[model samples]
Target: MHTTPLTADLVRGALDLERTEHGLLPHRLPARARAQCADPQLHLAESQPSGVRLVFRTRAGTVELDTLPTKRVYVGAPPRPDGVYDLLVDGRPAGSASVTGGNTLTIDMAAGTAEQRPGPVGTVRFTGLPATVKDVEIWLPHNETTELVALRTDAPVEPVPDRGRRVWLHHGSSISHGSDAASPTTTWPALAASLGGVELINLGLGGSALLDPFTARTLRDTPADLISVKLGINLVNTDLMRLRAFGPAVHGFLDTVREGRPDTPLLVVSPILCPIHEDTPGPCAPDFGALSSGRLRFRATGDPAERAHGKLTLGVIRDELARIARQRAAEDPHLYYLDGRDLYGEADSAELPLPDDLHPDAATHRRIGERFAALAFAPGGPFADRAV
Candidate 1:
């Protein structure tokens, strides 16, 4: 077996790769953004690498990756399923594996404390490849903080050549971060990118997609042919801003992106049908009653009447986002609006409710991806591939 040092050249979707004692740690946010962030949530979310993957080409019939993953667990909540590593051979789903044990981060939400316990590195192995030189992608766990330890293959490996697909850069909340999706490649953004025939750079920071200036700057600097921002959920749940501030903040984020990607197709997506937060305001809280039964659920504690005073809600955000997009599109033709409910609306929610009252399940993720691909990448759509 030949072991090769993993480098940034072999990685896609990450903005930076930090050298660690174990190996390279992929970061979705650049150093400038990381330096500007003071929120521990942002730090953790960015490092989780929602859309990051290792891309290479080899004729090896066997491949192995060693990784140390930091899995998060709530204090009294039921244990989470292990993080999954998905393998794609020549852009098709090949196989999936899960490591046994690794580092754990336990959080006591009530006590507002967290503790980390380190463990050994785990290995994910694939024994039967086609033994033909083909592009391969090993997508890391979307919701776990992973440290690449080593990569070994029976044959020499090299970086995969770019397939010349248009890159789609998307930013959203935990839903886009693949919170409950089956695996990395099955995330809504990933599935959408695949169906749309584009490369992906996902900045879906779980619970951290607040309209932070640094995040907007990071998007401003990133290169892409298409760009999208799924807004509203985190802001409403975090109670980070009032309606008065959301308009300008959204505009400022787009302004920053336009500074670098002036002509790139930009789509602004409002929050999907999160029924709990649809009419009610938030500062969403976990239902401890449900947690007692090992079910994690969220409920909006803020009153619906609070909208008169400018407290943000899903309904309010959707209206404002649509208005902003429409007003701006007159000057910026490339700018577009996608009412997120159109992807997962009241009808869809009735059929496939959010298991946790916030995130879509794996099946719902696929549904949303199919909806998004049809809407955004279809002929004459905002992000349509003209070359196709």
Candidate 2:
């Protein structure tokens, strides 16, 4: 039902993939040599005095992960060689382990956390995952820089089987990155994936969905049966570029994704409503005093008063996205548009206020997740029964 692309790029990573009669198999790179051409790493930074923190979602079932020794280590003070790591999984006190210098460890079901025991890079194994691991969350000890060098999962990810459900690939900003959400499983994207009952490849980089061409190329090369791109908010919040460049960038981004997934159900989503960007673009800054006092507050230099002077408004972004979608749909019927406001807007906020005026709170995540499932995964909508 799906057509393979003419060609594919070999991604750089130290991951090995194998397919057999049962399912896809994953193996860590062998010692003394990298399994993937490039390193598989997740970088987390702690600018403030507090230690750095790392959190991610993983299934709770039989799925497992091997955490390689974190290199490029970061700490404010002279490195503490034998610091205790207080690890929390899914908000629960899973376990605590002594972090020794120059060793990797593995955390799993039966064995909570074990040092790699002086073999190659010590491995930290995460096992005893939930059977229905909708998401995985990890909270690292505070005040130190943490770099996740490697993560390998048992995803049964053999090449697409002849008779398996399709995978949904999603790209977005912080919202998609599980910001302000209680846990990884609670992120709207994760929730949507669970309800849709599809494999997920989430490329939601917090504060980094800038419609970069390299990112577009990443999407273009990645295989998918369905794809959705959430845009606008990050561009406006950061004021990364003016309206002049945003439009063309959207066009180019979609164009790249289509290179490999020509007929895939591609949906472009504009920003959900934000008061700061309602009438003008924002370089939003919260009151530092309020922040110190534990009170959340945000202010915009480009308020409604400055709208006449030229600010980025949510309406402006929404309209531009619609324009882009219409322009492309003329040539590609598979392209679709979903106004993000339809998911959350001033109206929803009126009922359930956001924790901080910008990010949606926990309740809102559930609400939006349900709404998205209804629209994107309904029995027979435009996306339903479609193929890549």
Candidate 3:
């Protein structure tokens, strides 16, 4: 090995290296923040770009490679409401813990199980790291749809790098999250990240992307380089709001994201195809006959006549997003919009039926992720004008 003199200038330059303190970095942080690699906050939007890096490192062997630390939390009830969180060491099922208000949950690999006791949400410390362990991979048990309150860990914090790559913060319903998709890595956003080659901060909050102001504020307060908002489906499915509230809520949602990401690229996307609402507005109900026949179908809940004007369905949402985009374009030329049909419209669904009426399976998720990356990250794409 060639040996060069250890010079004072080399040390000076190395010490001078600095990254802006932001995003996910490794270091001694608040116990809650350190427990997870990235800040445990969700910023909802429509779509995400790719090609950004968020790196976290731990002392080699200092973190146990086979034991996972508790870093996930689920609020409210999910499809599987058995446990609030689970710990997986090295991607294998290790154990689980339950959350009761103000209760302390512990996972001690040394003890070979998890235990819950009365206490408050706080830092979680894991002993017996291999001392040669270089990193820890975290698997979030909850779907992307859920919100996060805190994270606690035992690593020193590092600064999040700008990396000169565009950051896409997206908000959408379950489809955006890993919903019916096979695994977390297969989620549309994750696939999009791999394809688009940009940094991502996903806020695909499963069923709650109803243009809630709190969700919007979450976006508003967070930082991003690019942003998008995917709307429709959820509101129609849940029958959450009427036309009056939907339109204004969308506008409000966009406005809120702008508060923090001023001058950032923003796109508004409508919902993809759903046959029942292709033309009619709706609180679309499951078709009993179709259910019995094992075909996915939906019907208007209210009067057939009223269905035409009552709520915003997939089609209606597309139209409204176009209108909204056009209306806002003069004021903000950087803002762009994409029709949901541009994604998986009726034809695509016909060929690839979603196993569930509400969520797309892994295949569809991959398809959508690829399509999104091609459009948003391709040369001269809608996001092309922005610095990416």
Candidate 4:
């Protein structure tokens, strides 16, 4: 077997890599941005490596990766499924597996506390590959924090060459962070990037897309041919800011991105249809009854009447985002606005209701990916060939 040290050049989509006692841990946010805030939620989300993966070319019939996965458990809630690692051979789904051992993070949602327990490292192996040398991509679990301990293959491997594809940098909320998606490759962003033939650098921080200046600056500095920002859901659910602060925040965020990429095709996407937060203002709360009944669900606790006092709702946010897009597009021809509903809306809700009243299910994730690829990557789409 050929053993290779996990190096930075072999990993794609992560903004930073940290050498840990176990192995190389990929980070979606750089040190500066991560240092800007000590929010635990942000810390964990950025470390999950949603679109990160190892890319190499090899003919190894058998390949194995040693990893330490951090699995999260909500005390008293149902046990979550183990995170999935997807193996793609020559751009096609070849196989998938999950690690057996790693670390466990037991979270108490109601009490807002968490405990971490260390565990043994586990190995995932894939056998029976084609004999010819082919490109292989091992997509890390989108929802779990994993440490890359080592790589072993029956044949030697080298970094995959760049394919000259446009790099799409995307930022959004938990929905974008693959909340309920089946695996890393199937996440809406990953699927969309595949269908659109672009490289993906996903910054979909679950519950952490609060339009922080540091986050905006992170987007500003990342090198990307195309950029998209999916906002509103995190803003609404967290009830982070009211209307008075939203517009300016959006502008500031866009301004920062423009500072580094003035002519880059920038797409602003509103939140998809989340019935609970559509008409009702948010500051969403988990439905304790559902939790007690062994189901997980959320509800918007804010009153619709609060709209008069500037509380934000999904509906309100869409209008504001549209207005801002139009107001900005007048000056920036490359700026684009996409109604999130065009990807998933009320009609979609009727057919594919969000299982938890928030995040889309796996099927919905596929639906959104297909729709987004069609709308945003088509010939007339804003992200159409840069040559166009």
What's each prediction's TM-score? 0.99, 0.63, 0.62, 0.99
CA lDDT for candidate 2: 0.56
> Candidate 3: what lDDT?
0.54
Ranking by lDDT: 4, 1, 2, 3
Q: Candidate 1 versus the native: TM-score?
A: 0.99
- In order, the Cα lDDT scores of the candidates are 0.93, 0.56, 0.54, 0.95
Give me candidate 4's TM-score against the actual structure: 0.99
The reply for model 4, stretches above 4 Å from the true place, is: none
lDDT of 1: 0.93
TM-score of 2: 0.63
Report the lDDT tens digits of candidate 4 across residue range 250-338: 99999999999999999999999999999898898888889898888999999999999999999999999999999999999999999
Backbone atom clashes (below 3 Å) for every candidate: 0, 34, 45, 0
Give the Å shift of residue 62 in candidate 1: 0.6
Off by over 4 Å in 2: 1-163, 303-310, 386-388
lDDT string for model 2 (288-371, tens) is 555555555565556665445445567888898999899999999889899898899778979977666778876887888777
Error of 2 at 242 (Å): 1.5
